[model samples]
Target chain A: MPAGFSAADFLYILPELVLIGGAMLLLSLSVLVPRRDGLLLWTALATVAVTLVLVVRFFGLDVTAARGLLAIDSFAAFFKVIVLLSAALTLLMSAPYLRVEGIRVGEYYFLILCATVGMMFMASGVELITLFIGLETMAVSFYVLVGFLKPNPRSNEAAVKYFLLGGFSLGILLYGMSLIYGVTGTTSLAGIAAALRGQDTSLVLVLAVILVGAGMGFKIAAVPFHMWAPDVYEGAPTPVTAFLSVGSKAASFAMLLRIFVVGLPALAQEWSLLFYVLAVISMTVGNIAALTQSNLKRMLAYSSIAHVGYLLIGVVVRTERGVAAMLLYLGVYLFMQLGAFAIVTAQRRSDIIGDELKDLSGLSKRNPLAAFAMGFFMLSLGGIPPTAGFMGKMWLFGAAIDAGFIWLAVIAVANSALSIYYYIRVVVFMWINQEEPVGSPIVIGPAMKVALGVALLGTVVLGIYPQFLFEQAEVAARTLQGITAATVVGGQ
Target chain B: MVETIVFYTLSALILGLGVAVITTPNTVHSVLFLVMNFLCVAVIYVVLEAEFLAVIQVLVYAGGIVVLYLFVVMLVNLKRDPEAHQDPRRLSLVGLALAGAVLLELAGIVVYSYSREPSAPVAAAAASPVQGNVEQIGWLLYTDYLIPFEVASVLLLVAMVGAIVLAKREL
Candidate 1:
């Protein structure tokens, strides 16, 4: 019976089990201990940190766990680290913000942990149905978290729009899954690739690929499927928005890489073209639209879209270096994007509207540290020299060129130049534009400081010494290729 | 021949009810049509020898989901027709173009499959045709797909919490 349901199988999913256990425990504690505001936050952070340690301990030890539904290799370890770091940082940011926003419910932390667990599932899932369920779990949790500020109509609207569009996209993705399953009669990544070897491509399979691509495009906020991102990001709680933009986006990319690269290698030529078109349009559309945004959150939302464009080039290349570059870029993104949003969260108060561009006016005069950090984040996001974002762009564009997609590199470079204008505009408002600031020097709580400190350290360290993280990413990418190799051997 | 006749009759009923569900002006009647469509689809499943699926379809879709639909339709209390707000412009041409494209694609697939050489079936190894349908499904669900089944329960739990958190009048 192939050692079904053994103790070792349970150990493979220990991190997820810990998270779900922690989430449920917190759900109960929220009811039992209603007044302890910091209790849930601390517990959630500890849970994620513990999970991170377990994943790191198992890194590079290639093993498929939970009866081959989940992989515990370097690839999963790498993304587990990303998802955990983002979750921990978001929880840190959420503590102070929640207090200020009067969201006293401990279920807030519960939902965040649940979502993180879902993302962890997405990172490790080797089966299509498992990934789909993980995606839905994450999506459902986000639907609630986006509308966490129940009194705010914009939050409600964002939640409704996200849920409706998200459900529709899920349907499209399910249809694609069913079609693929119908054609190959398997939902396992290794099996799918094995079945596809030497099999002639058909029109229905192409259509399935497109449908699946479209669904992922929506999650990562690629253009033409990115209509919901800005509104959702703008209206969501800043910490949740940071989580969605970095954490959820990273998880989606991980799922995409698993499905398209490992499972559908035979269709690489077709899907890479789809990604190329998506990349070009996403970059162009995101940068151009961001130019006129007055809300800082909305501006960053568009900027995220543009960043997804640059990330797509890595997928288009379909090389190990390309995937490594993408993973590195995501790591860089987690720091800078979350750092920027953490600064925004620090400024939130009942008396002040913090997300407007004018809220940043004369920020340097008020809180120099905050302004300096925000300025650095904007610089990195714009891919300026000597920042992690710049290094990330270099790696991605270099990979594209190495793969002979010179046009993609050229377009990305042009888009980077175009992106600088808007990213720098935020800097200009913070430093040079001398309008009276709307709020007092925002109090940076201890938790916020910790979150900001970690983000800053990651961003600056990676920017200066990119070689270490790059090597780790390379290992992770190679682990992914190992799956394909195994599949090929199985086919033989 | 009798199986073919039953399949065609159920398919027509399902298709006709699906159209009625979308086109009907009255909200309650539309929901009723949807329930009929679900029941017809359940019957079609039965004809295909998927007895377990047919039972679940009738129970979950026709019985459970239809009740929920009726509750929502009545609770919303539509005073004015919902379709009245739609644009009055004659956009039928665009709809027709899209529908025609879909029709052409389906036709092309049918033609291609008919003309191509028959390939070996892929799933035959996974489940032997001699086994009972429900037993085969139950074995696979508990064995190969156990993790996803558990995760699906988590998803349902999250959805339940979401509905309560978002829809409840008071926090």
Candidate 2:
């Protein structure tokens, strides 16, 4: 209806458009194709391939095509790559499970792609409403995916709990947004920051900031707001759990980084204190909770929360190095979390549907490769040397200490030590703990094998050659200079 | 005077209905109350002159999502009310304490703010010549926010498949 609004703008968002188009195509193809499962897998693979290329192409391009609301900077580009890679890997891991469970359908891939797009957009969102919409997109998709195994009462329970909690969080988030809008008279993050410049602290403004922080804290599964995670993780399909633990959480962190570092930098002193408290609480609670969990998935769920706490160390610093470290940690975390989940999926035999502690008993004797991979993943998660997890923690905690958060770093490092015990417990269970075989060795599918290999390779490669990732992170961090400007404006 | 009346009325209705949505005995009734609450919020949006958002509040929240809630409620056919029996003694005391604390806090803030005159509202009359409503939202969505938007659509697609896989009689 307006001039200058060309189809070319649509081209700028080609990756997202393509994903939507691919989803629709898959929906129809599932109906047309005789073998729905094969068609779904192939379609999903094709969609991801196209999306990967688009993301790569968009990443290098210096085009900010969305009227300044949606940035196409290297920062967003880096996250786009991360989310897409995670989506592709998750889909690969999911295919085998769907096939085995005889629940293969077009919607599974479609939802995964949709959720990935949401994650990608969340990373690039410069506006509040856009970020909220993206978050909802991811969340709504997950609500369904978590309950995808509908017949299972546990799955249903998981989905219902996740949905109800997610809905409540959304309300809090929206209310917070409304308050922010009421104060700043704008929904744009930049506009809010600019308006808040030179402004004195008001009761309303303080409340708004706290509310927004609380809302985001819930999304990131920070302690006191992480109640839904363990149940959801344990109940959802293994692949969906992997996506939730890594993809969704990482996307939220992207938003958190942008909001705190770029949009509300002036409140750094205040929010950083809140983050410090959260980081300590999340790590302690998550680790302590994991220690008591017998279920492997639930343990991993709590561990993921603790990992979020560790990552918050980077946020507390609010420096360029801190942002860089956060991104690197997320990149490394994707590998470790997904790799560990893949091992869990691999351990699922015909009789057993999950990697219970008992299921992994004597895994070293039966499936030594899986056992070793599992060990490596656990070691990496524990921040053991020469693993991606260790390097990620080093960069993050190192940045915290560098920014004068020496005490926070000390606590995080201590928690990292506490974590080693539990992570090693899983390793010990697989290698040392002995139990009767419940079923024969799991028939590992080719796709899952490749997915595991990629995840493993990423962990080791990033661990060994950290420079490439570091440079990429540096570039990403540079784009976040706007955050400092935002914080100064909002804080005053 | 009219604005004050409308704001207070809408706020009370929203808060009341919101509580009802959560606390109602019948699950279906709770969902209905939620729909009512959403509608009231849409009206409040209208009062705020956010016409686009108000309409979306009705369409997405009231029409679409609330229906989903109703569907779940019906499908589940929860025989016994989940919160039918609140431990009367403890529950009522907890509720009373919460209400009292909230009221006290609200009163304090109201009293504190009563002294200061309301600041000049920003951009009260500079209606943008360019229309920026839902259409603009869509325009921005297709242009700048295209990738994430499309990704959201894909997520919905995946959700559909997942739902079918999970809900179907036999895969």
Candidate 3:
């Protein structure tokens, strides 16, 4: 154990403790008070809100606790806030949808909280073991969440495929970590960096890097490993899909950035090359495949993959500016992506299979507000001007150019243009195209409206004025820079 | 000479049983072969003087997990041969080729590392006050890896809840 570590170390993780404790309490209360389902939703939301507050309170804290298993710093706090925001919004949006679908509410909320707790842990973890546990905790919770609709055979199929593939990727990740352990004899990120500096580049270490990349690539739904995303996203409940697409993806990127930037910077050349190739492939594949997707959920899933590719370009730059841009982009994505999915949830009705693109036909005629909101989100996602998405893309691609990766910046620009086609297709469907509505008029609940309203406000505000969020991201990125500097000094 | 002979015999049994488990047509027979393979591994562990690990191999793999597999196989209907629905694709060939390449790479790494060091033989250390293998394990788990140990328990609890939620007929 590191000197001066004690039970007080738990205080550093108070937010996560509150989340888990609240989840278990809710799980038990749900059994005793099954009739008051609304109470469960509020309880879950309050837990997330309190955790968010706690995370915000620790904005500039720089401490490594649990004997360096976890590092509580600005980076972790930033990601935690993003995750908790998504969780709180998801809970707010879930109530009416759960009632409409006739699914029980208590366990659903419990699982969501647990998944958020896992994401918090993943964001905070500084040691390989801690990171792995956090990854599994989140992954396992999501497996259940994806399959929550047990009566739907499609949901079951998606769950099985996701669980099997997730478990395989996790195995590969652990193998890589074990190999690193064999080489460095330590599981701590700082220790690994200290050991790796000036060390010979062995084949085993390269293989470890490749394996780790593959595992994380799957989590973020990057190409060649993204076979599970479309099916799973389409099959899961819309709210759950929204959570998985934004919350889980953001957390995984947080973990990935930390590992590559802090733990294995010595192998930057090798991994950056890998990420560059992955970025191009993911962007091309995700955009091209999405062109043919008629299901709204499936299209969004592919778009999410493309976003991951863009995020990778940020990671590829391997600089504080690059990481800050990525963080800023994720913050923007949290709003626009969740807003898009919330609109999808609003389209759900007993008679309607809302995932189909045709279900959105003549949406402008029936519900102008929803159609406008959806159009705004799609435009933002396409990186059109005057939205968070465009500014984010600009910052990210600019970071690449600044780092002298001109070719990568060019590819990202072309990919952004390619992505605009699909994103605009959704807009055309809502605005220009007219098909006879097969279902009744979609009713937008207050909860769904609130969710969409907040998302819209965030998207528009962050777009025109990104300075505040960019400053926060810069602070977070600097915390990581401090760690790498320490590792370099310690290694010497 | 006797130790080498015993080691090779155990290795052959383990290798052959592993192959039999995969190749056998009957599910029950395949499971039996797996049990035999597990027992052979336990014996090999004993041969390496890891009695505690050997016992765990028997208890966990041979006794518990294999029995669970047996129950699952029996409960699920398998009247038709599973191979009848085989959808052989080009991907399978690519998968095989990749697997072979990985195996070769692993072999090369092992050989290169071994030749580089010719590692010195390890000497047994003095026993702790706990004395027994399990006791020592308990002590170390509680003292050195207390966080991970507790976290594992939490993981199990989450898994338990997940299983019940996913498998239950109704909420």
Candidate 4:
């Protein structure tokens, strides 16, 4: 509390402190008090809501704390809001599924909170070691959440596969960090940018970029590094799967942008080119792969990968509008993806695994509102008009084409068209399949109704009126530009 | 001259004790030999002036880890040979080849480091304001890296809680 970390520095990370303290309290209360899951859920939700308020309060502030290791700025606030919103939704969706599946909700909520804290740190951290720790914190929590249903063998398998792959990629990421540190002689992003400014790119620098990119690519489930995603996504609890796809992917993208744009702006040419290939391959492979999956979760997994590919196109353009486009799409994706997963959560019955395409049959006949929400989600995910997904992709690809990458935009549109087939498949199953339901009519809990209603509102309204999202995204993206121009140094 | 003799003498004892720890017929005796080996390693660390590492080597390896190993040995009580179940597709020869490759690589590293000229010390390391190595570590962990250090501790806490939850029979 004396020179380096003062009382005021704690004010900078007050949101994280609240989340971590809340998570620890939840875990402790679970152990001591035994079973008060409803109480714990309310507490967890309040904790996230409080943290959300705190993070949003810092939206326009450009402040750094912990001696430049953490920066609570507009960019961080944007992603922190995304992570917190998804965590809250995931918590809401988890209650009903846990009750139906007979899993404990206490540790489940704690894991979600802990992972949220990790993502917050990932967004705010400006130093490599801090960011890596943040990454591992989130990853380790997901690994446990994935394998949470101990009696289920598929969950067990998914946990092991994810842990092994996650640990290996962490090592590669650290190796890249070490190489870059050796070259630039600093772990701070601004320091690295300063060190590498006007310098000739070397082989080791290129290798470091690739290794770091690949490690992040795995987190985001990009092509060639996404072998574990389908299995892990399918095996994980449906709510956990939703959180992983949305929160983890967004946090990883935040880290990726910080490293590439803020840290290595001097070598943007190298990374943009690398991500160009990854974007093309990831989109093509992910969309094409989603076509054949019978299980709804696996299909969404592939589709999320394809979405990341689209997001990468925004990164490739490297303009403020491009970054804004990426931010805008991720913001919309938060709603559509989670809205889709909420339906899957609702469909989970006692006797039946509700993720199969056939499980969606007769849903419209059973509950028309849920059926409509599912169809709306699927249409949005496919980038149809009058939805947020269309606006997101339009701005993203429009930015790419505006930057003179007409071919990239064309390929992207073609892929979006190809992606429609699978997206329509979900709608077709819900709306067209006339078979009786595999299980009884789904009875979504009050909490889940709130989550679904929120997601639905976000997807529909954000699409119909994109002005609010665009303005916030433009502000956030421009904040990153400000961060680059002066480049934070010697925080005192 | 005296330090050299002591270093070599301890090194030989370590190697010989390591071999005996593996070959001994009795589990208790093997564990005792392991403790002795760990103690010798700690002594070597002390001789090299890494007092913190030496203390940690004794406390963690010799004291804590061996106790866990001993507990496992006591509980498992393997009556049959542990290696009796050999799979038909076991690639022992391939494993041996890989081990040999690693050994060769280590030898290459030793040869290369010894042959190469020692570069001047890195001038870029920001000079630590603290004096001692341990003090510097403490200072940094408490100050400059306080947030990261705390986050890492939280990581460990989550991992511990998660492992327990996953292994729990009932909540």
Q: Which candidate achieves the best DockQ against the true structure?
A: 4
Every prediction's TM-score for the first chain? 0.98, 0.96, 0.97, 0.97
Which runs in model 3 stand beyond 4 Å of their true positions? Answer: A1-7, A486-492, B1-20, B40-54, B79-140
- Candidates sorted by TM-score, descending order? 1, 3, 2, 4
Candidate 3, residues A1-492, lDDT tens digits: the string is 243347767678788888988898888989998779878877888888888888898899999877678888999999999999999888878887788788878888988988887788789888888888888988998999899888888889889989999999999999998998989888889999999999889999999999999999999999989999999999998899999999999899989988888999888888888998999899989998999999999999999999999999878887788889999999999999999999998888888768888889889999999999999999999999999999999999998888888988898899899999999989888878898886878888777778889999999999999999999999998898889873221100
- iRMSD values, candidates in order: 1.7, 3.9, 2.8, 1.0
The residue-level lDDT of candidate 4 at A247 comes to: 98
Question: What are the per-residue Cα lDDT tens digits for candidate 2 across A310-417?
Answer: 988777777778878989999999999999999887766556786577778888888888888889999999999999999999999888877778888889999999
What TM-score against the true fold does each predicted structure earn?
0.91, 0.85, 0.88, 0.85
lDDT at A241 for candidate 2?
Answer: 94
lDDT of 4 by residue, A403-435 (tens): 777888899999999999999988888889988
**Can you tell me the DockQ of model 4?**
0.61
Could you give the CAPRI-style class of model 4? medium
Off-target runs (Cα >4 Å) in candidate 1 are: A486-492, B1-9, B80-131
Better TM-score candidate (2, 3): 3
Q: Whose lDDT is higher: candidate 2's or candidate 3's?
A: 3
lDDT scores of the candidates, listed in order: 0.87, 0.79, 0.85, 0.88
Worst 10 residues of 2 chain A by lDDT: A483-492
Which 10 successive residues of model 1 chain A have the least lDDT summed? A483-492
Q: DockQ scores for all the models shown? A: 0.42, 0.27, 0.29, 0.61
- Model 2: residues >4 Å from true position, as ranges? A1-4, A60-63, A482-492, B13-168
Say which prediction, candidate 1 or candidate 4, comes out ahead on TM-score: 1
